[model samples]
Target: MAEQKERDRQEDDRSSPLIDQYTARNPEQFARNLARAMEELGKVAAAWTQAREKGEASDVSAAPIADMIKTFSRVSEYWLGDPTRALEAQTRLFAEFMGIWANAIRRMSEAGIPDHAEAPASDKRFQDPEWGRNAFFSFLKQAYLVTSRWALDLVEGADGLDLATRHKARFYMEQVSQALSPSNFLLTNPELFRETMASNGENLVRGMRMLAEDISAGRGDIKLRQSDASQFKVGENIAATPGKVIARNRLVEVLQYAPATENVLKRPLLIVPPWINKFYILDLNPKRSFIRWAVEQGHTVFVISWVNPDERHGTLDWSDYFEEGIRFALNAVEKATGEKQVNAVGYCVGGTLLAASLALMAAEGDERIATATFLTTQVDFTYAGDLKVFVDEEQIAALDKVMQGKGYLDANRMATAFNMLRAGDLIWPYVVNNYLRGKAPLPFDLLYWNSDSTRLAAANHSYYLRNCYLENNLSHGRAVLGGKKIDLGAITIPIFNLAAREDHIAPAKSVFLGSSFFSGPVEFVLAGSGHIAGVVNPPVSNKYQFWTGAKPAGELESWITNAQETGGSWWPYWQTWIEKQDGERVAARKPGGKKKPLGDAPGDYVRIRS
Candidate 1:
């Protein structure tokens, strides 16, 4: 027993060096933060002393100080309240996990393997040889699954935590648990362990080098083995939908797709993709391109490709986006098609901006938009899912500091935040493949587009989160744009609202809630997939399904309860809706007429990297 203890101590001592290598930089950062806090406190103390000496009244605002204490108390309660109960829960879960492993070991000793579904169907990591068939590996997977659940439940089911506080707690806890999963480490992951033996540790060496490169590039937290940006080129393999740039501005480039059908709808369609990402998401490939699909549906399609902003465009605001971005594209589409009215579609943040523009336009007595369609958008952000965990004033202030320093929100930083929302699906699996197994990343079009992120100008991004996300002013009729309070209920056009059931960024309930604020007749559709997939689903794929009803209720859950399920994509339904709103078909307008083509589809603006 003494010798075992000695061996364990030796092993722990050896592990310390490896742990220190990863954690050495954290101490300095912590120290810097502590020093800054102390400095600020000192300044406050000095000011208070001066005020007291000058016969001025009390210290800095007691109300704000009291509020700060209350906030800290709430945070502390979340972390440290009911210590005994938390400890008991942890102990019970640990025992349960140990018992599971013991049973597995006993079954293994009898030369038998246990068949158990330890993970959800969505988690593909455990499908590896380590967890599927082998007895010992199956035990590890079960133990891991048990422990992960315990850790998550400990935070989620904790007492004295409000709904919002518990959600935030669980989100961070899940991230930590996922990052520390057995599948993400070389020794613990059986497949990687075998591979390491086969390659004589060469893979580990390669993985170490990869880790070094990532750390040097400051992307260590980006666990996914993202696609090589070099493999993709705009207007070539991806975003290859044949089209011509009809108009260009400092903020956007409007591309008009070549007609695929003989006769096209007289009313043109204008699509506004979120500037947070490049526009190619809607035009990824010919097989799945929404632009091509719309054109093939006998509709003249025009999309705005937003310029990837930089320090040069730091001062651009929402007003600029309305004036020079969507509104500008609207004018161009009208001029190019000679159609005074057009049907408009907005996806994600683009939807938010489009709704703002429509409200402002309606206020100004502009009736250019005939029909409005929103795809996975949240104009009313009251219940905007897990992303809102960081929407509090303190977090926003911290984000403000970051944006102020960089002039624009860094693409990597924003990507990291989004990835955190779905870490188990997107992050840990790649951590295992890229770092633990030392494998190269494959070429995936969706991931390539995900990695191909665009910067958000400081002013624009800050205003967006502050007003729409934080203030919820857009739906409340107090959202100001171009010095006017834009009211959502003012725009009474036919509306098609599509919300994804599994969207983490924009919750379906919030999207549904936003629909209630619109005075127009709304066709609220809920699709079965996530944000991107839900929007890009094509009828030809015959993949996921959607739910729709005659009239949606005020509550989302009730609407879903009464909604009817339909197989295949929502694109066909959207097409039918568009056709009904559109006028009689005419000879399809060519890509360009009097004016020359500015450039090819997925134009110069998309080529710019942040």
Candidate 2:
């Protein structure tokens, strides 16, 4: 109760400026708002006695709305007066009052109720239909309609309105972005979501993707880790979950939680971290930590911990990522495990780099690599999922402008971009709760983690877009890497491929396309989830599903023909294939030959930040 009081106080404090804003500078605008408030107060008074006079077509029929208006009287009283003194006060007060009503509408919308989708709240078609429609009172509708009209007037630069009203309108539309506001209509409707999905009718795909993500989140059983400091010390072991980086020369070090047994066991494996976020997505917690599971399973696991890039790293490109990212990590893993013939597992962008490494190695005839696995990784970007539509000329140009200002893509900018892709799910749900219900949005683990993002080097992004996505060079069995032409056909070693059934960034079929270009025997598995969750899937969390073919599920058509559907995570299936290929449990020892680390395991280049 005390904490709630404190929070309420803080919110009031934050809202105070908005209340006092127009009082001093804008008087004319205040009058319009003052009239609206008086008008609402009059309606409320009538609604209380008249509208509720039995048979007055009551909107306050709902227990919730009745309770809401009973409180609104008290809440609005602070703002509702003669509409005479300091008209600016009236304007500011009305704007703030409207904020409350807007929030209320939003809360009601989040029930996924269809009646809320349209205005005037009649002719209802929500899941609850009859039960939900009659909930709102005609009197409350009158109050809301009047205030909303005032808001529209304020927004349109209406004359005779006080400086505060006009300022509120002009200010919020461009700068305030009532996007998260309880009353925001943008998120509640299917318009925004429909626009994106309209391109491919990816409704089923999106549903599958979200289902997989939920499964992954369930595994994490993840607890929110909040802090004001970046570097945190816990039990003498430093774990860095730096949610974001604002300054230069900083990083979020996701802990590599391998079990004690993996400390010495053979078959060194370096887990490829995706470029989209911190590596902790894979090693979320003890229950969901793939690293912990792999180590417990007796494989010496080492993960590539990437430095959060900044403006200084803007010029870094694909060549730099290979030399310093995968190559550098491989060198360190070799030294740690004392084995040059280690396995490699690539994920998303990291998987692409692994594939690039294979070609780079195959070109040089370096076969220290024993086996390779690509989880939801794509080399061919022709059908690059939902993300492809975003790469259209106009959108990319807008992105270039946005990126130009920072030289490096800002992490939050990326977060916002992706959030727009699922605006209804990620943004609107909270808007409704916080605004209409005077409630707090759900602090979902996935949403919280989704907020954590990382920047990609401008040059690296350019290389990826042009060489891989645009040119399709990586899929043609020909692409240059490490000063030599990389040929996928040259890699005769065992290869494992898994693509997410619901992946939007890189469609499963598109990812499987690479297997067609490879000469080696290929095993492709289609996992049950989307991009991230599909790869991070663990065993304890069953109930998810996957698909695999007797041979390879390469190309959309053939894979569609031969695919065999399965009903559990592909993790166990992968373990069987991996076990068959991995021979001789050579005790884990540090490499002594050319694989020796130049200095320490983490290395200087990786540690290198802005």
The TM-scores of all predictions, comma-separated, are 0.84, 0.59
lDDT tens digits, residue span 363-429, model 1? 8988999999999999998898877766767667767776676578767667767887888877776
lDDT of 2 by residue, 1-610 (tens): 9879855654443344432411323345435544544454454344445423543232211332333343334333433443543376557557655654565576566765332223344412122222233334322333444444444443453344344333333433322233432234312322222221222222223333333332232221111121211332212122222111111112222222333452444577767777776565665555666666776666766666677777777777767777777766666555554567878888888888788888887777777778898888887776665444334334455556555555566554455445545454454554333322223334444444454566777777766766776567887855666666777777788889888888766688788777776678888888877876887678888857887776664356676567778776688787778788864565433332333223332322233321
**Cα error of candidate 2 at position 299, Å:** 0.8
TM-score (C-alpha) between model 2 and the true structure: 0.59
Residue 183 error for model 2, in Å? 8.2
The global Cα lDDT (0 to 1) of model 1 is 0.77
**Top-scoring candidate (TM-score):** 1
What are the lDDT figures for the candidates, one per model?
Answer: 0.77, 0.54
lDDT measured at residue 223 in model 2 versus the true structure, 0 to 100: 14
Identify the candidate with maximal lDDT. 1
